[model samples]
Target chain A: MKSDMSTIVKTVTDFLFGFIIIFGIYIIIHGHLTPGGGFQGGAVVASGFALLFVAFARTFLDKKPQQLYGLFESVGLLIFISLAFLGIYRTFFYNFLANSGGLFGMKITQGINPGYFNTAGVVPLMNMAVGFEVACGLSLIVYLLYRGVIEEGEDGE
Target chain B: MKTAYAVIFMSILVVFLFTAITTLHPMGYPGHTEMDDYFIKNAQIEVGANNVVTSIVFDYRGFDTLGEATVLFTAVISVVALLRGVKKDEE
Candidate 1:
C-alpha cells in the first residue's frame, strides 16, 4: 500500500510537470505574438522539472549526470549561437524559414494574416534556444543548491 | 524583554512608513510622449523582427545581448573547470 501510494504521487507529479512544460513551450513559440517570451516561460518549465528533482531527491539525479542537465545546457547554447549567426548572414532578424509567400509562390499582402506556427523569422528560433538555455541553467542552479554547493551559513557548527 | 520587543516593533514601523512615503508620491503619473508614439508606429520597419521585445533586445540593443552572452559563457566555463578540479582533487 505504501509503494502504491508513492507510485500514485509520482504519477501525479509527472503529469503536472508535463503540463507545465507544454504550456511553457506554447508561450515560447508564441512569444512573437504574445506577452511572455523565452526566458520567463523557460524558467517556469525548468522550475517544474526542478520540483520533480526535489521531490524524488538526489539518487534520481545522480544516476546520469552526463546525459541529463549538462547535455541540455550545451545543446541550448549551440542552438542559440547558430540561430544568431544565421540572422547575421541575412537581414538582422529575418525569419529564414518563414513562408511569407504562400503555396504556388503567391505573395502575402499586408492585411493577410499568416497563421500561428509561421516562423516569424529568427524570433521563434531564438525563443526556443533561450528557453532551453534557461531551463537547463536554472535546473543546474537548483541541483547545486540542493547539493549544498551554495551554502547559506558557515560549516563550523 | 517586553520593552525591547516594543522598541523593535516601533523602529520597524517607522522604517516602513518612511520608505512608503519616500517612494510613492500622490500626483506622479506616466507622461504620454510623442516619441513613444513614433516608436510604436515604426518599430516593425526599423527592427525587422516580429516581436517588439525581441527587436528591442536583439536588434536595437544587440551589443547588450552580446555582452550578456559573453558573461554567461565565462561563468559556465569557470564552473565546469572548477567542478573538474574538485573531481581531480577527490581522486
Candidate 2:
C-alpha cells in the first residue's frame, strides 16, 4: 500500500494543517467562553496531525516523533492530576482558586457582560491540560498506526 | 424458520424502543431539573466562570473527567506498547 498521498493531496495538507492546529488551539483556549472544550479541540488538532501523517509519511517515520508525543501526553495528564490534587485541603477537585482574586480568580459580573479571560480559576488550566494530553495521545496513536502499516508492508516484501 | 424468528424479534425490539422514545419527556423539559437549575444559577458565582457547563465539568464533576483522562492515557500507552517493535525485526 502506498504510504504517502499524491502531490495535490500533500500540497493541500501542507497548506491547511497549520490552520487546523490554530483553530483547535483557539477552541481549547476559549473553551470556558465557547461551546468547545478540551476533548473536542484536541480531536480537531489530532486530525491535522493525521493529515500530516498521511501526506508526509517519510518525515514522520524518520523522525520518530511519536516518542515525544507520548512524553507530552504523560506530562499533560500529570498536570491535570496535580491540579486536581491542589485543592485537596477543601475537597478533591475543589474550586479553591475560584473567587480567590488570584490567577484566573477575578469575580465575574453577575448579569450580562463580556466574560473575562482572567476569571474561571482552575477550569481553564484543566482545560489546557486535557487538551494537551488528548492532542498528543491521539497524534501518537495515528503515527503508531501509520508506522505499523508501513512496517507490515515492508515485511511482506 | 430462523429468519422468521429474527424478523419477529427485530420488529418487537424496534416497537419497544420506539414506544420508549416517544413516551419519554419532551425536549428541554426533563422530569427532574432541580440540579440543573442550581448549577445554572450558582455556577457563575461559585465557580466564577461564565460558562456554567465548564464549571460543572471541570469543578463540580471533575472526578469523572479525571477518570476519562486516565482511560485515554491508558489507551494510548497500550497502543504505543503494542506497536513499539513492529519495524525493529526488519531493521
Give the distance in Å from residue A11's predicted Cα in candidate 2 to where it truly belongs: 1.7
Q: Highest lDDT: which candidate?
A: 2
Give lDDT tens digits, candidate 2, residues A1-157: 4557788998999899999999999888888887888988999999999999989998778898977898899999999999999999989898778899999899987767798888888999999999999999999999999988888888799
Please give, for residues B1-91, the per-residue lDDT of candidate 1 as tens digits: 9999999999999999999999774676757798666656654544333456765665455556656655665665566555432432566
After superposing candidate 1, which stretches have Cα over 4 Å from the reference?
A1-12, A66-68, A89-115, A148-157, B1-35, B45-51, B76-91
State which candidate has the highest TM-score: 2
Predicted complex 2: CAPRI docking category: medium
Highest-scoring model, DockQ? 2
For model 2 the TM-score comes to 0.89
Q: What are the candidates' individual DockQ scores?
A: 0.16, 0.76
Question: What lDDT score is found at residue A12 in candidate 2?
Answer: 98
**Lowest lDDT 10-mer window, candidate 1 chain B?**
B80-89
DockQ of 1: 0.16
